[model samples]
Target chain A: MAADWIVFWVCAPISIGSAIAMLLQRNAVHAALFLIVNLFTVAVLYLVLGAPFLFAVQIIVYAGAIMVLFLFVIMLLGVDREERLVERLRGQRTAAILLGLGVVGEVVFAIRAGVGFSTRAPAGFGAANGGGNPQALGRLLFRAYFLPFEVTSILLMVAAVAAMVLARRRERPVASAERRAQEPIEPSEPSEPSEPREEEPVG
Target chain B: MLGQFLSHPPVELGPIGPELVLAGAGVLVLLGGALVRRRQPRALLLASLAGLTGAAVVSVSLWRWRGHATVLGGMVQADRFAVVARLILLGVAALALVLGHHYFERLGEERPEFYPLVLFTTLGMTLITAAADLILVFLALEILSLSLYVLTALSRRLAAVEGSMKYFLLGAFSSAFFLYGVAMAYGATGSTHLSTIARSLAGQTGNQALALAAVALLVIGFGFKVAAVPFHMWTPDVYQGAPTAVTAYMSAATKVAAFAAFLRVLMTSFQPLTWDWTPIVWGLAVATMIVGSVLAIAQTDIKRMLAYSSIAHAGFVLVGVSAATQEGIQSALFYLLAYAATILGAFGVVMLASGRGEEHTSLGSYAGLCRRSPLLAGLMSLFLLSMAGIPPTAGFIAKVNVFRAAVDAGHWGVALVGVLASVVAAFFYIRVMVLMYMQEPLEDVEPDPSIVPRLAVAVPALLTLLFGVFPGLVLGLLERASVLRW
Candidate 1:
């Protein structure tokens, strides 16, 4: 348990530091890297929390995929501006410090109050099914939350169409009134003599 | 085999027939929309309109049916409470469709997805109001929230995009807090089912600190949804920026659904912890009422003012929830119905007057409306009066019911605070009325002869009077609705 605490203490600074760096870093690519580090640390934390599935998901989806997308977007945009450290005014700096302190205080209070961990037995205890493992989640998805899951898919489809519609600029169709009036005198070869096309001239 | 399987729980399928019908209609409309590409949305519109009417019929059919029962193995509930609440919700959905049809037509932004989403969200809201389990409640909240997020951004304007983003971000964050609270409460107790929690917590002593913290987190989460003070920073911006029709639907249906869920959770599950939460709720209720009313008077924009008015109404509903009495629940239900009609009508008129681009968000734009369109002006006045809790308006009866319930619950101080808030709120409502009727025309405004918006406004405006004068009608329906078991 003491070893676990030492491990947590060591990882905690790197995790929190990377998170703050990710938010404050002006260079988008560096921010993405920092975020990946933060997410990897989170996965480590999840492992400590005995949530192996969540740890895997955190590493695979968030650190791997989402950060890659972030990097890709940053590279595609080609914005390599150097980090500009923001000069905080005295009042604003004080306000920021106060807000940060308040948040820290709240966290301390919550910890002191012992409000985070469960007193009762954790979910999936002595049960065949567990808390949202891949298989159990799949079964729950298909059986209980099937309708909502289907609806989410529909929402995704709508979102795809909406993105396409919003991004694409299609031209409006015009009747070309003058072309219709001036170029319409010609007729295809007739089998028989046809009456001349009548025109009513405007006054 | 399916029948035999479902019969074990003895499902109350009859009560949920309306929701099922709406759900089916939503899918049908979506399919019909895809099939009829050239004349897209016409068929969808017809189907959704038919669906809304069908839902109303189903609501009426269940009106005579009473008592509490579970449906779909406790995933959904249908009782006297949900029946009346759903009827109100469906009615608002129908009006919203009418207003949306006209608004979209004028703006040339008609799409088939809008109506179906609205109906589905309404169905979700009905389920939310009757949810017995915490998981079902969360799912229902998501269903309602996601649809509204899309609806808020449907206009695709700059303000709409920004407002929807803010609303979505804040809403998701609040939901996280709520989910965490649910997790903690479930940890503290042994179940996610509300009744089980209630039963488990009954006779359990000590741990007041944890219990208070749980309820506080829960309140913070629900406070955002209901737009209570301190968590209401998003309400005005979202309301002012969203399409007026969507705002109308949200202000009415969303509030009713959230309050219903809030009351059920508190009265059923958290009643044992009442002493810990009542004072906090009382403080919140008073603060919300005063701040909502006081701040509303300072707003120049009409939509912003109404947004604040909604916050104040939320306070009133919270008062009832705090009372934790059957009368309190019933009164809140009645108030919800009245407020739904009044706000919908008010927003309907706002939609009519604002034209394609919705430029009439400010209070000054309403000046000389009487000269421009007397019929519209009169309707707007009636809505304002109802909102102000004037006699013979549904708002008045609704407020009285809540006040009576609070008094009966021996919360005279809370009731007094509510009355004070109403008095202050009246000033702004009357201010709008005076602007519409007493002021002279400043600009040359053309009256838009759109029967859809007018009828939409008129029906609810008339209902406000009908129900206000005959409060017994809706109240009787509400009385027949059974509060859910803890």
Candidate 2:
């Protein structure tokens, strides 16, 4: 009850506030720090759910490992120097507008359908198809779905490491474009600085 | 079937030995890299190599296993076919590790995560070959792709990021298609397990239209992965943009794994739907081969050229698949093994010859490569020749095997088209050879003096020639493994 109360009162507003602040912060370092606070609140929320393993993992993996990576990436890429807000992905606005339109269209379809989801299974598909989501998922998730379950764990591990690799390279002694860009340029295929700042519009 | 599955052991550990070993190894590498005060990332690389070798050994030991063909509640196929595919994937991963190690060490970088990412990718690819359930197949695909997308961007070049973005977006779209197909399949057959689906298909139960829709969508998903044309808009850019090591590794491994799943899903679950899907494969094969070769000839970037060449190669493999015969599977296996070796070595040379920052990958830069470093040029020549399907090289025999399989299955038109495409491909391969020997060397470009990468490249180069000269070396084993037991 104490944990629940603290989560609702202390962590809730703080988490929401930090998330908003994280989005607004111009400085990458400050933004990253705000994210860490938000992550901590998420771990507390997980603790309140009685998922101790998930709570520990949320803190250690997200707040500890991933946040450190964010900071390192921010510091190493000198992104903090580019304090001016520049949309890294140029077409994001267009993408968002299109996505918004799709959502509106979905809402219209849902209205026409009377019910968004069918309570009764489609004809000839019933308990034969494992009637409900949770029932089927529970059957598959723990028991006979051994390969997929184990594979998912490995998939998560790979995804985490890959995220690190994609975002977390230090400024080189390593063979990177930043160092390559410093050297005399090649006539063709100039390796750019690879930072997510104002990119030229090309597919 | 459900009763039988339940009657067996709930979690059979014996059939999943390689996966268990791979999981342990992946964790070991991940944890070792994290905990140890790192010296050379070479130790991590060595650890990964040991893990891959152990997995391969376990797979080999399982060859011709006498017990049940399905294990883990029929979620995985415990067959020689899976064993062979797993072995090939494991071997290529080991080579890719060495190449990755050399690529980084030469650059004076110590990325402890690289080896783990590679190990995990291998784990995914091997799992894909054995996965007998649609859910497992999708999971394995995601695992390999997520790792690959990250690995592509690991070089952190602007081009690398761009390529990663294209790959990630398109890959997500494909994954959705695949998942939707799985849903459709469940609707049609009331199960996501391949064996149950097969039984449903054979019995002509469940909705036929829904089942057909599932097949088409699943094909589109696998087609994207294998870089089959019409769905292959990302190939050239991603190939040219990714770090050469990633391109080299995934160009070979991804095709093999995707095609393995493709063949298994089609032959196992949709065998009764044979008449429905072969024409689709026929169209894909024709379009992929023709477009892949024709577009490749117009490429200037070496990586992009190799990209299209790989696309053409996929068509050749699909020709085998289109045959819908056991011989076709055998030939496809042989084709994958040879292509893996040839592409790994070709890209290894590109990695070595890319000068200091690994930037000199253009075809023009490769001019006078022979004069500057004869060893790299020779290795490059051997690999290119193999890729061109030239005689006395592995590619020649692989092409012959697949084309012959197509012909035997009465796919004469596809077999003929494949031959024509191979001929067109040879022009570009020889064009590279001509550039290396006939043209003057670029003064600014300097190949790295990395001995280990050179050795790694040499190993595959030797194998390429050996397999070429004697097709029986690996083909003998493949012949035994092609008999799918599901």
Candidate 3:
């Protein structure tokens, strides 16, 4: 139990600090590396919480694959220019601080409440996890949650189609006159490396 | 062991027949696009229409289930609530597809994926309506949003790219909030099924603080999707930048899907916490109405103005939700259908009005639309009049239905605010009508005479008047569907 507290105390600050550093870093690559560090700490926390599958996923998928993609995008887009950090929108900083403080206050209230999950017998994680966590997960996924598992394939297919559309070359057989009239960025876009469009952070 | 896991809970196919039909059709369109590369777009359009009609028929057929609330191991629901919402989503998706088909076809481009993606989005919308579990709900949401992000970016124009990017980012953030709420909910109740959550809450065995936090986060997530105030910063830009067809589809269909899920989740899983959540929804409703209407009056772009107007309509639906009664649920259903038909038709006209790369969506461009194309001009006025809640149109009855429900639920104060907001919303809607009818032509650019898209849009315009004049046509069924239970 004390080891649990020690693990939480040690991992919590590092995770949070890396997250803050990730936010403050101007160099995109460094920011991504910082995010990896934060994810590693989260994995450590997950490990201590007795969820090895999640810890593995956290490290392999997020910290490994996603960070690689982030860095690849950063390099390709040439957004590594070290510029002075400045707020593009006025009051953005103050707004950020105020919002951050509000979030912190909410978390503080939640912590002060100190209300862990209800310890009802059927509700306890350990009860369902007895036949091993992965086995339980497998059973649940196949039996109770079959529909979502199948639907995820559709989501991936849509994303594939989207990628194909965005990566199309200018030499494709679009109407020449309309292409010339409609697209100002068509010529330069063939190289496919503009300032990185907003990339959503994957969970 | 694997066989035991697979066969333990037998899955029901009847409840999800509409979703299956939609999925099969979507995949078929993708294959058709890939295989038959010549003159395929038109054929693809026909196939997609058949898909929608078939799905709607499957959904209608599910009505024989007659009040079955739990199916698929309580992971999916079968009820008139889901059936009606499915029909509405399919209707909107069909309109959006035809409008998009002609919009791109007029540009002389072969966008084969557009039809399939719309079908896919419709599938998601229909699936979410029937999602009885939190996991299924989130999955269905992703299925819809991912395709929508692609559809919004289908044009690959800078503006379209920007809109899709913003939508993708903000939507991902909100989805994370929703997932957190789901986690909290599961932790509190040890169940992801809505009925089980309700039972847990009713039994008072759940952690109150955790449940309350979960409710707040879940509302925030749905609020973003519905474009309620404070979470609606993306609405105007996304709407203005997206192709008019995509905007029309998403604006109408998304509200129906998200609000259906929202009604199901909050009104079911969190039913025991009704008093605790209503005040929050009340606040959201008030803010969404006041801000959405007032800000709409200041927009110059037709799409942006409509964006704000849609935000205001979201507030009206939230009013029904805040009432927290069976009548409230029925009225919200009516309001969603009304808003869907009205907005879909209105944007179809906007599609016609903005011809040639959709460059003519500004208010200045619509100075004399009536003289140039009286059919379009008249249809626009009718749709806008419905939006403004004028009598003899769907919007008026829809508004009255919601307010009456709120009053019945002892939420007369919110109903009163809703009435005033309707008046303010009327101003901007009427402003557009006045511009179309009275003002002189600003630019003599010819609007598209494309009959297919026009014919597609006219169905909704017809529906708007039909439902308004005879509200009883659908109200009787909605009354029964409104009786939501475990």
- Residue pairs whose backbone atoms clash in candidate 1: B80-B481
By lDDT, who's the top model here? 3
lDDT value for candidate 2? 0.86
By DockQ, is 2 or 3 better? 2
For candidate 3, lDDT tens digit of each residue in B292-379? 9999999998999999999999999999999999989999999999999999998899999888767899998988899999999999
Residues forming the 10-long window of minimal summed lDDT in candidate 2 chain B: B4-13
Measured with C-alpha atoms, the lDDT of residue B272 in candidate 3 is 99
Chain B only: TM-score of model 2 = 0.97
* Count of backbone collisions in candidate 1: 1
DockQ-derived CAPRI band for the predicted complex in model 1: incorrect
By lDDT: ranked, best first: 3, 2, 1
TM agreement with the true structure for every prediction? 0.77, 0.79, 0.82
Lowest lDDT block of 10, candidate 3 chain B: B2-11
Q: Assess each model's interface with DockQ, reporting 2 decimals per model.
A: 0.09, 0.46, 0.40
**Residue A87 displacement (Å), model 2:** 16
Better of 1 and 2 by lDDT: 2
Complex DockQ, candidate 1:
0.09
Docking class of 3: acceptable
